[model samples]
Target: MAEFIEHNLQGVDSAILAVPVALAEGIVWEDLARMVKDEKMAGNPIAGLIDKLHFEKNCMIEVVLALSAHANSQRWYELKKSQERKQGKTFTPHKKAFKLAEKKIHLQLSQV
Candidate 1:
């Protein structure tokens, strides 16, 4: 998990910072299933688990979006300032899902 986090630094950092509680437990299927389930049952759990997984996935998406937006906004400000000062404009946010996530995050941040 730590290796995965190091490999995906941006996502891991945001995830760690944003969902600290959830991260503490780690991303386990059964735990997540239980979290989203309406109740624990002895029989037929996949449907509930899947539904819960979807919900949890959406929640994580929201968190990712918000974190990306905040980081992007800060970086944008610093980059612009540096460009103005002729110091440098070296940082370039890559084209990836992280960029799209920032849009959702920006909206969330606005509400906050």
Candidate 2:
């Protein structure tokens, strides 16, 4: 995870900053998924960012941490479990199905 993040710094930072704004604007993970798949993300913030980073789960988890959502990785695991329980699904998140599980945390050490 650290290695991946180290390799993809620029894209990751974009994801971190862009995602929060998106969520504030009412964009959902599902919407991000559709945008990514359809490649119709023109005018969408994360569009054209694809080539900058490749989506990976560890990086996504790190993004969650950076957002101060969970305090620590253990809490993150708990959140993951709770989310799985609520959704009745497994690693849709870990597989990058969800994109931050769709902010596309594709977010860095030099991260903002």
Candidate 1 clash pair list: 65-105, 66-105
True-vs-predicted CA distance for residue 73, candidate 2, Å = 12
Top lDDT hit: 2
List model 2 lDDT by residue over 1-112, tens digit each: 3344445556556666665566579877667546555563455434444433223442243455154322333455666778779676555556666655345344433355
Expressed as tens digits, the lDDT of each residue in 1-112 for candidate 1 is 2233234555445443433455456856556556435343544332222222333454332223234435544554666676776633233344455677999899999999
Off by over 4 Å in 1: 1-19, 26-29, 39-62, 65-112
Measured with C-alpha atoms, the lDDT of residue 26 in candidate 1 is: 82
